[model samples]
Each structure stands twice: as structure tokens, then as C-alpha cells.
Target: MSNSDSSTTKTNGDQFARKGMSNGHASGMGHATVEIQDGKTVVMDDGRKPPLAIVLKFVDVKHTVAIESRFSWSAKRPFQFKRQSAMEKEILHGITGSVMPGEVLAIMGPSGSGKTTFLNLMGGRALRGMSGNITYNDIKYNKALKRRMGFVTQDDVLFPNLTVRETLMYAALLRLPNSLTRSQKIKRAEDAIIELGLERCRDTVIGGPFLRGISGGERKRVSIGHEILTDPSLLFLDEPTSGLDSTTALRIIQVIKNIAQAGRTVLTTIHQPSSRLFYMFDKLILLSEGHPVYFGKANGAMDYYASIGLKPLIAMNPADFLLDIASGNVNDVSIPQELDKSALPNGNDEAIQPPAKDVREYLVNTFNQELAPQERAKLFALESTREELKLAISEKRLWSITWTQQFSILFIRGLKERRHEFLSWLRFVQCIAISLIVGCLWWRSKIQTEAQLSDQAGLVFFIAIFWGMFPLFTAIFTFPLERAMLAKERASDLYRLSAYFMARTLGDLPLDLVMPCIFILIVYFMTNLRVTAAAFFLTTLTVFLDVVTSQGLGFLIGAVMMDVKKATTLASIVMLAFMLTAGFFVQHIPVWMKWLKYVSFNYYVYKLLIKVQYSDGEVYDCGTGCQSVGTSPSFHGIQLGGGGMEAWALLLMVAIYRILAYIALRRMKTGG
Candidate 1:
């Protein structure tokens, strides 16, 4: 009998014998051969057939994979540096599997069995060294496959702020071929929605955290819908049934099966399954310890188990039975290392091999016999060539919306939010009420005595500390409320960080200017510091400066912290430091510590206000007669000039603080 290897060669040779039989000149020339050289096809022809006429088409796509390691840990180690120290632990051993066109393959394993890891590698999420080959129609696949295949991550990454239609539209716009028109894009999106059964709530918004919109199942569908809109030939889903009830899970699978029947390939990893769910898969790939235990027809799994002399219990789940058999081998129980065809007396082994008279083989043999004519025809019909798919990630963002738009949206949204509204009103009311009550107690300084100087000092000290807290309080409250939303919006590419920051800074200005001015004016009139309008304006400006400075500082802290508790703590610490170095109270500070007063917002505002108020009023002093603690000689330094230095200091301090706050706000808004 002819050896199969030699027979294959002879078959190949004989197949090319009739290539040029139409004329005698090309009769003997039909004999030609093709061989692969240097990983490329090289055709050879004796003076017989035309060398250029010899052609061979081999499918070039492949699914090459190699994963040696994977480590899992919690949030404590964001980079997982420690995990790299131990490289010997291979979470996923070199796993290799592939499916051709019209093939359905399933990966079955127990929980944490690296099934998800395998899927992640296929999706290009898990980084790993890959070997072997995964070819599609003779073409070697690469990252370009991302365009031809769809990946559904474990998490349903949907935006809480957008409706289902909006979410799908955004993804479609980003992923769809640029050549498609707007109407075509919308049509594609609508088709996906209908296919995924999201039409019922297409207009409903997706919800998360404080935002509420759609149900979880609908959200999941939206996630899948986004991917399906791309119309990829290969779809990889990670636990599509996770978090869904069995009924819903079955429905999802049915949808997937429908997709598979429509000439696309779909593969997914599923955990424990009900009997109905188990039967849904076209092929079963049982895995254990990152090794394939069995990969073949799912219906034959039970018989395969029995063939190994492991009898399964009646009515048992076939998958569970096979898993038990694999698990039983964990202790290294001995079994035959190879299949022995001679040992099968009933010829069952030969039945497992390709049947010589099978209809499938007959069809394949006939197709090969007619391949020459088929190719000649296909050469004219093949029109799939087009521009290469290139994913151009945009760097210029949609965040360039003007400050007015950003401010309007943020303020309106902030006002609608219970947390921001409640905190803002409470703080505002507190400021107004305290100003009124303090005004009632220390009304229009009667008899402006020497004791009034002490009162003025007390008033200045209280003003610096209270005003310093304004920025701190605003930051603590605002940061705690909107930090999370900012992060979410940034991730979704909603707006530019700079624009958002600018808008927010501007938005709080009206309130900042109003609150401080009101409190300062109320106090100034009540105590009646000095009647000049310029002095009144200076006093009010100091209060405005305090609030404006605090608002900026609050924004910086809020932007920097991002976390509520952390930001609040940081803001508190900063406020305390500012108060200590304000130089408004306990004027006698260590010389080394005095320099801190220069940079303190509180110090600048306090100094400027005192300068303005003193400039407006006259202080009686007897030359060389004044005695004060720390004054070496009993003398007043040249009669003090009631100067207007406070006005200039107030402007300078406000400008500096606002600038710093703006920089911080920009960073926070952009997730920098």
C-alpha cells in the first residue's frame, strides 16, 4: 500500500496534470509544482507548464498565543511591583487554540481557572508573550484584528450621563468607518440596538452612583450594542452571562447563537451552567490547570469520559462529569500516554478518523477537483480590497467649549444636586447670620476709647481667621461633591479640563464676591470704622479678597485631593497654617516665623485692611511717650501715617491666590 505522505505528494502532482490540456503546445507544460521557500510560495516549472501560471492560495490568518505569567492582587499595589519579584508562578501556562471559519469553540473550566485570562489574551487586554499561529483564510492576524473583531470586556463601561442611544452613537462615531455618512452611521447604530434588544429603552439614560437612568440588563445590552455596531466577524465576550439571571443568560446566549448562525464567529467564557445553558454551545473545550483536558464535540463528551473507563452517574451533567474525571487525575493516577488504534477490536478508532466515504470528504474532494475553474472565476469576483483600517486616536478634544457654556452647565447641575446645594446654602446662611449678629453686638463703636483699639484688634483677628476658613470650607464641600463626577466625565472624554476649571472658577466668582462683600459691609457699617467711601470700599474689598482667595484655595484643594475625606483633611491643615501665620493676632511672633506672614493670604488681607482703616482714622500719640511690650525705648516710630497700603496689598494678594487656584483647578479638571 502507498504511504499516506507519498500518496499526498502524488495526489498534488496529478492534480496539476490537466492545467493546459486544451492545446498540444501546452499539453506537457501542464506539469508544474509549487513549494514554500523562506516562508513564501516559490513556483517551479520544467520547460512544460508556464511557470507564471502556477498559483497557490493558502489562508494566512492565525491565532498565535503564548502566556507564561499572570498575577492578581488588590488596590494596595496599583503597579504590582512585588508580584514581579516572583516570576516563577505562571498563572496561565502556554495555552494554544484556534478556530477556523464556520467553527464554534467553547472554553469551559471552573471559576478562577484562567478562562477569563485566556479570553483577555485573545482580546489583547492581558499582555503576554505569544507563540504558535492563528491564521484566518491563510492571512496572519495582527493587532489590526481589533478592527475586524469585537471585544466585550467584563465590565459594562457605559456612561451614566448619556442615554442608550447617545452611548451607542458615541461609540459608533468613534469606531465606524469614516467613509460612512451620518445617516448610514445612525442606521448602523439603530440596527445594533434592534439586534441587541435595546429598542425598548433606547432613549433611557444609563445610571451609576448618584445618577440614575436604566436597568443593569439594559446597560449590559448597551455595552454589547456598542461593540456589535462595528460589525466585526469575530466577537469575544468575557462572561456574557455574569450578573444576569438564568432566563436572561439564556436569552443572551440565544442572541449570540443567532449571530453565529449569521456567518460570524462568537466565542465566550461561561462559568457554572444550567442544563439548558450547557447545551447551547456548539463545541466544548474543557480546561484544567491551564491545560486542555478535552477539545471536541460537546455531545460526545460523556462517551469520551466512558471510553476512558470512568463511568459517570445517571442524569449527571456531562460537563461536571468530565471535570470530575479531570479532577480525579489531579493525584497523578496513571493512564495510557497515547491512543492505541490496534487495541480497538470494534474499529471504533477508525470511525473517529476521517471517514473515507463521508459526504463532507466527498464535497471537499469535489471542490478541490474543481478548484482551478473556481479560482479563475473568483479572481474576477474578489473585490474586498480597500483602504487599510487605521485607528487614529484624536488628541484634540471636544473640551474646547467656551467658559460660559461650561459654567452654565456646571452651575445648573450643581444647583440641582442636593449635596452641593445644601452645603452652599448652609454656608451662605451661616456667613450672613453671623455677620448680622456680630453687627448687633458691636454696633457703631460708641465713644471710640483706647479700649476700642483693643476691640479693633480683636475684630481684625476674628476677621482673618473666619475669612481664611471661607476658602477652606468651600473647597472641602465642593471637592467632596463633584470630584467623582469630574473623574468620570474626563474618562468619557466629555470636556477639556482647562475649560471646566475656568468655568468653575468663574462660576463661583459671583458668590465669592457677594458673600465676603456683604459680611464686610455689614460689619464696617455696624462698627462705623471711618465714614469715607474709599475706606468703606477698602474694608469691603478686604472681605472680598478674603472670600476670593478662599474660593481659589478651595478649588485648588478640591482639584488636588479628588477624594472627599482626603481633601477635607488637606484643606483643614492648610487653613490652620494660614491662621497661625496671618499676623493679625498675637503680633509678637518669632523672628524666624515672621517671614511666613509675607506669603499668607490672611496676612496680606489683614495688613491691607489695617492700613486702609488706620489711614482713614487719626491715632493720638505723645512723642517718645508710648510704651509697648517688646519696644526697647518708650517712643512711637515717627508719627504713624494713615496710609492706603491695604488697597494695593488686597489686589496683589487676590491676584496671586486666584492665579494659583486657577493652575490647580486646571490640573484637577483634566485628570492631570
Candidate 2:
């Protein structure tokens, strides 16, 4: 830890920045460069409004991850693979840094050097087992700070169906403060679209693995657009250029530079960047084994190491040199005589170099003794004026709109995104194919005899049960698939959970019923169940009710499990029980299980469907004489159906089950 870079440390190479950037690999970028400028003049805050100048400081930030061991050690055995034990391992050891407005800080490290952990801790996303003090403008992290910050995660968690413009517009509506008018929010979104250079793909859909849409670079830009819609004072991103090409990554870093130039304090983690990309950052923090090797001006990193007698044999990318140092791949570099001898590893053999672990420790110890205290004291001694303090504590309204407006916005957004899924050709074909098969098998049954009546009953049973399971499986994936996006949006306080849930359920209601309506319309006429208009409409209503109730059950299970395999397994078990007690295959349920049938919504819907098409006076021809179908053993010898009561039961379940599902989601931990 040379720790040569301090808050006031200035590299002696500023005059040569242009000369250096114009040579070698940097020349390939042409005129596009990320050069730090002596910033423009800025005014201090008045008491009326928050300060545009924001400085974020993180002090002694340490994170220890609680790992559950797959194997346990106990008195019974030396090691047991079947048992588990609790263990703690600190992934981040007192990571410290600060960023001022108009500056971009890049955190570079080896794969497991806690780059992302440090970013999250500084961003307040990973809260558990973290001990640290993070402040904005010298105030501790609070709701005001939270509302003023934006985070773009490594993997872009975006809705594949939404266009880039719609994505930014919705973010604008949801994240901007309520003080802004609708026109103002729209203007802000438009500015973001223009600023992020997404004008060409503004209408492009953000496609997923199965879909082809925008290019990777555009997707990353759209992510940045989402965060900057509110013009947050601080922006933190996790590996914005992870998978892009060299040109694209440079463009992204340029965009981040532009953002920082706009007075937003920006911090990002880089996965091994090229020299041109490395030169873009104003500040840099190099980590190895969760220890800070260097934190200061990015341009001065090489000079700092050179002062400590560690220099590359040949000219190399500053980022690569730092990574080589972090990885202990420095055989080509010259080591200081004092460090080589006085800070030697515990070994008699001096010809061989020390291991990477020992090198990391040596750097850590050096930083602790020589520089950590000064930096720590300097960071701890920061103080702000009364106006700046008020500006830091000032909080904007988190939700931009009223509850009703939020629901309406989410409703329309959901509708636009879900239209293609529900109305796709594959879904149409599935519904049409199943309905046609059922219709043809019971074609024109005409119920004049007991045999035809029996076929009618079978058709009702098939359609009712099939639609029940269909909506359930479809709805079950809603929360699980969207868990990531939901968490991300909710963490930013985009909308209330109630508004989101209501929009999700009610918004999908119209789309969900469209296919079912088409299916029932085709099959009902073909099967010739009942010719009366009232009976036909009533039958459609019953199926719709059954579909809705089953969907609610799926929501419950999905919310509780939140995993596809586990939720599917539980759904299967539950539906199996409902079917057995439905009195379809078995007339008399076990006495011990008699109470179970009342809980299954299928029990009531089955009888109601029969009553909708069949009447009490209706009789079927017997070999000996005529007999009442309603009283016959084939009908389970139970009262076939009653009006109003069974539908009420289904309606009640719809409300209760969905309410419980929403409650479950509320309990879920969405990181901030």
C-alpha cells in the first residue's frame, strides 16, 4: 500500500496528459477522449435549495459475508458432509475512498478482490454484516441521500418488451419528485434520451436471451438513462462495460465521463480496461485481496508506484500494470530494495519471490503503518457548513405521483409490455387447438338422450379443469420471473407495493381473459350444451371466475416460494388434492378428508357448471324407465348446484388469496 495518492495529491504528469493520450493505443480512439479538466466555478448552497456540489465519503467500510458450510465438523465425526455450520469470512477489509462532484472514480481489482462488494457498500445496497459510515456532503446516508442516488447494476435488469423511450419515460414518471409537472418529467426523460445517445434506438425494444433487439452497447446506455432521469446527485454503476467490444466500452466510459462532467458524482467498477479506457477516470482505487493498494488520482497511480521503486520493465497499460501488481504477476517489475529485504516473507530462501498472498499482506501492512491513519483521519475530520448540512438532509418526495396515478401508470406499462405475450400466435394456437379438440369430440351432442347429456358433462369438466390449470401455471411465473426487476424498482421507491400489485393483477385481468373468452366462445357453440343466451353467458362467466380464482392461488404459491421448481412442485401437490376431493374420480371422500373438499374451489365450480346447463326436472332415459339426472348416482347424489352462493365463494377466494400474496411480497427483502 504505497498510499501515495491523497485527497490533495496531484500527479506531476498533468502537462503531459495530451501527449500521452495521443500516442500508442490511445491514438486509435481518434478525437473521443475522457480527459479530466480543471472544473468550472461553482457556488455554495443557499438555505433555500440543495447544493449541486455533492461529495460522497465512505470510511472504514468493511463487509463480512456469512457463509453456510456444506460440511460440518463435530464431536461425532471429523467431518460430516451432510451437516452445515455457520462461518464468517470478510470479503471487504476496511475499503475507504471518496468522490467529489464532476469526478469519476474507477475501482479496479482482481476477480475476488471485493470490487462489487465495495461498490454495494458505498451504494448502500448490501446492508447485512456491513460496518461502515457512508455520507453525502458530510451527512450520513439517509432517506434523502437514498432518494438522490441512482444505481445501475452489472446485468441490466430491463423489461425486454419495452422500448428505450418508454423505459426512460416510465422511469421519469416514477422516480422524479412530485414537485415536477407531467410536462417537466417528460422533458427530463427526453433530455436523458438525448444525453445518453439513445436517439436512434429510442423506440427499440430491450430484448432478452430468446429475443433479438438492441445491441449490447445501446442496452447499457438505456440502463444509464433510467438512472439519470431524475438527475441524481450521485450515480454508482457496477461494471458498465463488462461485455462490450473495445470501441463500445470506450464509448460507454466516455458517456460516464460526460455524466460526471454534468456535476454528478460517479463511481464505477471496471473489469480490466484498456489504456485508453483507464485514462478516462479522474480517480482510481486499486484493490488486491480486499486491501486498498492505491486510491488517488488515476493519472498518478503509475507515478505513485514508481516512487516506491515498482515500475514495469516495458511501458504497459496503467490498468494492466495495476492488475499485474494486484495478482502478484510482477516478476517483470522492479521491486524496492527496502521492500524486498525488510518486508520479506517468512522464508530462508531469498532467491525465489514471495507468493501473491504474502505480497498482498505486505502491501496492506505498509499502507496501514504509512498512510491509512492519515487518510482515515483526513476523511473523519470532514465537516460541512449549516447550509450544506441542510442541503444534504433535504429529502425529495420519493413517489412522484399519487397512489391512483401510480397504479394507472403501472397498469398501462404492464398492458403494453404483456400484450405480445398474451396475444402471440403460439398462445392463440394452443387455445384454439385444445378448444377444437374438445368441441369435435362432443360435436352437436344435442342432449336429447342420457348419453349425449353425459358427453356434455364431460366437456364441461374438461374445459373447466383445463382452463383452471392453464391460468394457474401462467400466473405462477409472474412474481418469480419479475423478482429482479421488482426488487430493483422497489428499492428506488418507484411505487408503493400496493399500487404495483393492484396494477399487476388488474392490468393482466383484461389480457388474461381474452384467450379464455375466445376458447369458450368456440367450444360452447360446437358442443351444443345450452341454446339459451342466459345459460351461455352464465357458463362463460363461471369459467372466467374459475380462471381468476385459480390465478390467485398461483400468485400465492409463487410469492411464497419465489422459485420455479419449488413453486411448481407445490402447485402440483395442491391441485392434485383439489382434484381428488372434487368428487370427479371418487364420489365419497375419506371421512378424515371430508372437510378438504369444501376448501377446493373446483368442488363448487363443478356443480355450478352442471346447474348452468342442466335443470332439476331434466330426465334421462333408463333401460327400465325415465329417471331424474339430478338425483341419479352419476351426479354424486348431492344437491347439484345453487345460484349466487358458489360464485360468492370463488369471489371471496379471489380477494383473500391475492391479498395474502401481496402481503407476502411486502415481506420480501428488496435491497436499497
Candidate 3:
């Protein structure tokens, strides 16, 4: 229904201009510009004026990590490994810089030089184990300050199944201030969509490797859009242009420049950048081995280096040259004789190049002695003249939405994200195929006689086992997969942990329960375990309890082990153990293991299914005559647990496992 030519772009631009005029979000000077981008029509920009906001400053920031951590542990004796106190290493050493409104600061360095670490400290993503003074508008990082900040990580943490519009809408709902009405929040989300020029693909899914959706460049934009929805004044991006092509990367930088020009203070870490991209930054901080080599105007960086007698032998990208200098690759540059000479004690060897480490040390020392003092003085002077730390945002609620609103919004988002897999064509076919096979295999399992009654009990047990394992396997991956996204949102103070936990755990119900209902309808009638309406619903309820309890165990295991492969493997082992000890597979678990059946929630499900279909002291016809169930060996282990206990036990397990999962998730909310 839409076209992608320049005329279409013009029309789209006009439509956006009118919408902006109506909503008062794009308050401006004049008309909008339109451009044709990659066969898609997009508005160039909306006329929004800059509203000066924040000035970010950090001083003497440092961070250290254990050199001999778990990765260094022995494979043969992993449990015996311990890190000595001496095995610590510094990651960021006395790094300091600042960026004010209407300016974009780019952090550049070689790998392991702590560019991202420095950015993380400034953005308030790293707290403990870090020594620093990171403040926004003269205020330290806090819940209120967090609400006004945004961070785009190196890896785009997003719901791959949700459309671009939906992702931004959910962020708006959860992250916007409570002062805004529902309609206002929705308006804000729509405005972001148009503002980002994502109108062409607004409804398209933000896909992953397996799912085809938005282009990588657009996906990156959506990541930016999510943070911008709250109208954050301070934005931090860790390599937003990473993995992007030259033109796309340049475009991304330009967009970020536009954001900075709108009175937002932006900081981003970038790798090798082209000359065109290099000139876009207002300021640059060059790091080397966790030490600051240079912190000054981006345009004057090369001039500063040249003044210090370090200049490239040939024309090259400024970013590449800076990286070379930061990496101690001064051999390619004409370094000052004073710095080039090494402490070899052999001679004043003009013929030999200094060691890389020596070169790095010189760069660090030179900056600390000359430029650092002046930079600090200027930033402090600016800070003194700035208004007081209070931004009125500090008194606002840390979380934007009420508990009920968060629950409902998050629930809907979860449902949308999961529907592609939960209600997929393949899943539908899988449910049908499995149910048909089970129904045909257990056809008309008559329970009139003693022998057939055992067969009926087998069918009941199989149903409980099937639903139990199905949901557990599926639910095990939920939290582990979402850990990164959860960490990012939590850092931004988007929503309450309790709100997210409840929404995620309970939101799965509608989709999780669908296939079970369908499978039960088919398998129950075909197996003929029970014929009456009450018996049918009771059986369904029993299986649902089994599912709920098992899912809780899955969540617990997943939350505890945030690795997908490890969590899935552990779930398999745990579920297998539960099934074996639940009295269905083994007649007599050893006395020491007898207590395990009580611990296994599967035992409860099996018990409830039997009670639903059969009464106490029930009898069945044997070859000789009607016989009591207690006299038969077929129902030996199942009957001993007694009746009227499964429901409460299963419900208890549900609560306990969910609570434990929530607690585990809280430990990771701060990304500790």
C-alpha cells in the first residue's frame, strides 16, 4: 500500500510535519526535509529546537578486575581453583573527561584500552569496584538521574520478534514519567517513530539471525529509538556503528550528531572510523592500556599530537592514526627523540625503536603532565557556573508506571514476543502430531477391570509427564535469554523488578496454556480415561497444575544458571530425576530416595490425576472377581500418597519456585 520514491518521501514528510504540529513535540522553525534512502522513503529531519539540558563530568575514574578469574580455572580441577589477591589488574586508570549539552564526545582506543569501560563509568552502568566521580548536571548517578539517561550497548539487546513500533511503544509506556497520560505516552512513541525516519519499517519486526526483519542499520536505530523515547538528555552508545558498513556508519554518526545538536550530551565509543566520520565528533578521548593518552577537541587531536613531535609518516584516517599512537605503534610516526629513546642502558641507540610498553608509558605521562591539569580546570570552572544539580526530575517517581500498569503492559509485550514461537506454524503442527500419536497409541484404555485399570493409570501418568516436560523445556530459556535486555532496562531505571518478574512469569499463561488445552481435549477423549464433563475438566486442571509447577522449577534453574546450554542441560537432568522418583517409572525408590518423590512436584500431579478419575477404595474386576486397588501391584506406589493433598502442594511449589526465580533475577538486575 506504500511507495518508496522521493514523492512518497515528500508526502510522508508533510504528514509527519502535520502530526508534529498537532502534538507539539516537533516545535520548530519551518518545513521538513525528505530523502530517498535505500529504496525507502524517509524524512530527513523534523524541525525541533534544541533545549539545553545536561553536562556530564567524571574525575579520577579507575576500575580493576581479577586477572585469574573463573576463565583461568583449571579444566581438570575446576572446583579447586582460587584467585590470589595479587592476581588483580587495573582496567581503567585515572581516566577523566566531560561533555556538555550540544556536543558529542567520542571515546577511541585500541582493543582492551578500556574505551567501553570508561563509557560505562560515565553512563553509571558500572558502580562497585569502580572509583570515580560521574555526575550529570553536577549530580551523581541516582534513580532520578537514571530516568534522564540512555545507553545503547555494543550488542543490541532487543525483542527480535516485536515490530519497531511495538518495541518503542513498550519502552515509552514503561520508561516515560508518570506525569504523562496514556495518550501522551503513545503520542511520544509515534513521534519517535517518525522522528527517526522509521515510518517505512515501523511495523516490521526487529529480527535476529534466524528471523528476517529489519536491516542491521535500522535495528541499530530502533535500539537508539528505545532510549530516546524517554527524551533522555544524556545518551551513551558503546559502538553504535559497530558491524555497520561505511555509509551506514556515517549515517548513524550523523544521526547522533543531530541528537547532540538538539542539546543532549552524547558519549560513544568507536573503533576505526573514516575521515568523514572522524570530523563529526566535537571532542575525543584517546586511551591506552587504561590510561588517558589524550583528551581534547576532536579536530585538534592531531595538532596536539604533532605539537608533541608525534606525526604520521603518511596521510591516513585520523582515527587510525590516533589508534596507532594509543596502541604504542609510534614506530610509524616521527616520535620525539626524547620519548623515542628507551632505558636499555646499552646506549643512546637512535637505530633501535623503543619497546611498545615504553612508548605507551611516555604517552600517558606526557598527557598527565601537560593537558590533564588544564582540562580539569576548565571542566571545574564550567561546572561552577552551571545551575544547581536539581533538575526537578529528582523528585519524580523512580519508576514511571504503577504496578498494575507495568504488569499489564509487560504482559502484552511478552505475549507478542513469544507468539511467533509459541503459536508458530511448526509448534501447531508439533502439538497436533504428538497428540495424535499419543491418542492412537493409548486408544480407549478401558478402566472397567483390574488389568485395564492399570492401562488407564498409565495413560493418566503419561499425560501429566508430557505436559510437565513440555513446558519445563520451553520455559527454561526465558530468563537466561533475556538477561542482557533485563540488565540494560534495569540500568535505565525503566521498571520495577517486581513488576517485570510478575509480568514475565504470569504473562506466559495465555500462550503456554493454549497447546495444553488442545492436546488434552484430544488425548483425554481418545484415551477414554474419564467420560464425564466434571472428570474431563478435573483432569485438565490437574495437568495445568503440573505444568505450572514444572515451569517454576524451569525458571529457577534458568535464573540460577544464566547460560542457556547449562540451564537446559540441568533442567533435563532435574526433570528426569523428578519423573523417575515420582512413583510412575519406579515402584520402590530406595528408602533414602523415598523422600525425593515428596520433593518431586510430579508426584503431586500423578496423585491428582488418579484421584480425579478414581475414588477411594475403588475396585476393579479381575479374572476371578472385583478386586480392591490396594491389593494389586499395578497401582502400588501411586496409591500410597493418599488423596486431597496434591493441589495445595503443587500450588506451593509454584509460589516457591517463582519467588526463588525472582530473587535470583534481582541479583542480576544490576548486572553484578
lDDT of each residue in 223-320, candidate 3, tens digit only:
88888776577889999999999877876786677666554789999988999999989999999988999998999999988988889888888898
**Residue 23 miss distance in model 1 (angstroms):** 63
**What is the descending TM-score order?**
2, 3, 1
For candidate 1, write residues 354-428 as lDDT tens digits: 221232222223323433244335533533221121222233343323455455555543333333433467777
Query: Can you write out model 2's per-residue Cα lDDT over 1-672, one digit (the tens) per residue?
Result: 123531222212222223323321111111222222232222212111212557888887888998877854678875655657788998888877688877999999989899998888777778779887787776666555667778999999999999988888888888776788888787767766655556788888999999888999889888887887665778899999999998888878877776666557899999899999999999998898888988888998898788767799887888888998888766778777654664445477554555677667666777677666776787767655435333525555455679998999899999999999988999999989988988898888865566766677778788778878989998889999999999999877788889999999888889999988999889988888778998999998999999999999999999999998899999999999998987788876789987777888887788778778877787777666787778555556557557678888889999999999998888888652
- Error at 290, model 3, angstroms: 0.9
Best by TM-score: 2
Error of 2 at 251 (Å): 1.2
Off by over 4 Å in 3: 1-52, 68-86, 343-352, 386-397, 616-619, 637-642
Worst 10 residues of 1 by lDDT: 20-29
Better of 1 and 3 by lDDT: 3
Let me know the TM-score candidate 2 reaches against the reference structure.
Answer: 0.89
TM-score of each: 0.52, 0.89, 0.88
